[model samples]
Target: MVAIALCAIGCQNLSLPSASTATTPVVIKLSGWGSDPTEQKLLKQVLKDFETQHPGIRVKYEVISDQYMDVIKTRLIGEAAPDVFYLDALEAPFLMSQNVLEPLDAYINSEFDLPDFEETLINSFKYDNHIYGLPKDYSTLTLFYNKQAFATAGLTSPPTTWDELLTYSKQLTVDKNQDGRIDQYGYGVIPELARQAYKIKAFGGQLVDENGYAAFASEAGLQGLQLVVDQYQKDRTSAQKSDVGTNSGSEMFGQSKVAMVIEGNWAIPYLKETFPQLDFATAEVPTINDKKGTMVFTVAYVMNKQSQHKAEAWELISYLTGKEGMEKWTATGFALPTRQSVAQKLGYEQDPVRSAFLAGVEYAMPWQAGKHPAAIMNNFDNQFVSALLGQQPLKQAMQRAQAEANKLIRAME
Candidate 1:
């Protein structure tokens, strides 16, 4: 009965055992947000492979599709959450502090190769010295540029410093029609908090205070963010999604509306499939304030505290995050493997485009800011965009955003 329901919703080509099986196997429920069709197919294959190895356990996978966090939180509060589920690093601190997630420290052993995982990726899920989750995969931002655009602009190489990037943007910006409308923007900008977190740190500013309140309005933070505003308002060389009439920076870059964009590994496959004829290459993101910085995003498998199948749940989590399963899951490049051994085996570091992303892992900042990042990010993005559009001064805008974010955080507390 459970297998039928699972098969009806996004589980492809899953074959379950008949009722005549010698022993009734334990059913372990797993849940995650839906991804691209190719990614989903790969994940389902991983789950099926696990089931084949452990005939005593039946894995039931479900896709929440939308409003993933809200659905998971509701199910958790009602004690009906799946035994294991995908938890983003952005949400890890909040959930780990709530006493709702099971600590996996006891379940992991030396042979599990705990040291094989990336230090930063594993540390994101660590709270009070207990590991609550294990990162399945991670991605870091890289500079994506169109080779043809660079050639047309007579540029020889991608920018390595912020000053060079600004200069290059001017050379790359063009208006072929001379109708006072830009035919091609020099750079694509995504002004969201996720993409800009490292900017705040570049100038010695932080996203939150020691008490977990919003504190990005410091002079240091404003100093770093000013570059973005100046590029948009003064230079007019960079554009947002609405300016280009595209859905995302990736789409805008793929459409040749922009010459360069800061994107992650996921965009590699996307650009290949959607714009095969476009000549593009990647480089490490330009340095700002003479500092190297980029953002890292990762998702982990976390166990539910109230789950009845804790043992089986750990088995699934360990296997999926283990070297073997991660290799198979990340083999197709939907996401980069988090394990060092798997990364070595996959040899993505040698790939031209991917090597640029791999270079960022050493200095990338995890996309997390305490437990209330969602609230902080929401307020900051709203006011930051206003500042970018010249509605208010950058300093004033950040001050207002910080105040509003803290008020909401207090209310939530």
Candidate 2:
């Protein structure tokens, strides 16, 4: 009887038992951070549709508006976490290694068409041959360039290489008045590790050693980072958010403070809505060291191992990440679908603004650095910014960051 029930709930071909037949609907909780209002509305609709399909199950969705990870962690320690929750790729490594997540391999079967998902994304949630979560969607970084700025600068197309990007920056930067205070910079830079990880990898630098120790202070790493420092400090072609009195790269580009910025898919809608008059387009991140690279941000739906309604939780996870659910979720272009079939069906590759982001999926680096990612990321960002600002030598800053991160990782162990 138990085997039959499990199959009826998990196997798509098997008809689910009607609500009338069940004594009570099994209520399962789902939790994730708050997003755009439209995104939230779409999710609620998806959940409603899920309930309709499986009348025997009810979903109680909760939004953790701020400090999502911290709240989730506290709940997990108390065994009060939701049955299903969102886990980002960066945080996936730590949680997957902790043995608190349900290994989803048993629930997944051939009918799920697991092959449809992007390999890189699916692999992020896998540990020791057991799949812990299914990536719901992902985004890749791409160059967002202002078309008017390009035209005024007499440039025909977006930069195809880092060298070209730097050259274009110098040409695009302009000052309308005779004042020394420049009105615009060529590029807007986000000096955080998440944004610069691919740059490090461009020159064959590893973020961490096999033992999970920070290893980004190598010569290869410095070689790539030097490009950023030089562009900011020496050439003065790029401006950070603080420099331009903006909160984000999108804002800087929207205000015409920078002609170009490397940003993720989320910037598309924002730019369109906030700055309706601005004309912009996107291209794949320019190649560095003759290698194509960008960073990918992905989040997955993971199940709590301690959930009472394990089967129902699996049902919700499978449906949300399944092809049908993914299609509806990604139709608005808020996020790029992780499933290849869905992407093809949506025709995102042909989308002028999103095509570049789609093109980058093949070479994009997942924003993860082993189990102790926070230590590595926080330390690197702090030191890398100092280097970018000329407060310290790039080599010295990275070395100090690497040592400090390793020390923290050691303490965690």
For each candidate in turn, the TM-score is 0.94, 0.94
What RMSD value applies to candidate 1? 6.5
Model 1, 333-368: lDDT tens per residue?
A: 878989988988999889888988878988999999
- Per-residue accuracy of model 2 over 1-413 as CA lDDT, tens digit each: 22233223333332223223466999999999999999999999999999999989999999999999988877777668898999999988778766678888978899999998989899889999999999999999999999999999999999999999999999988886869887899999999999999989999999998988999999998899999999998899999999999999999999999999999999989999999999999999999999999999999999987777788888999999999999999999989999998998999989999999888988789999988898999999999999888899999999999999999988877
Clashes of each: 0, 0
Clashes of 2: 0
Question: What is the model-wide C-alpha lDDT for candidate 2?
Answer: 0.90
Q: What clash pairs does model 2 have?
A: none
lDDT at residue 341 of model 2 (Cα atoms): 89
What local distance difference test score does each model get? 0.89, 0.90
Worst 10 residues of 2 by lDDT: 10-19
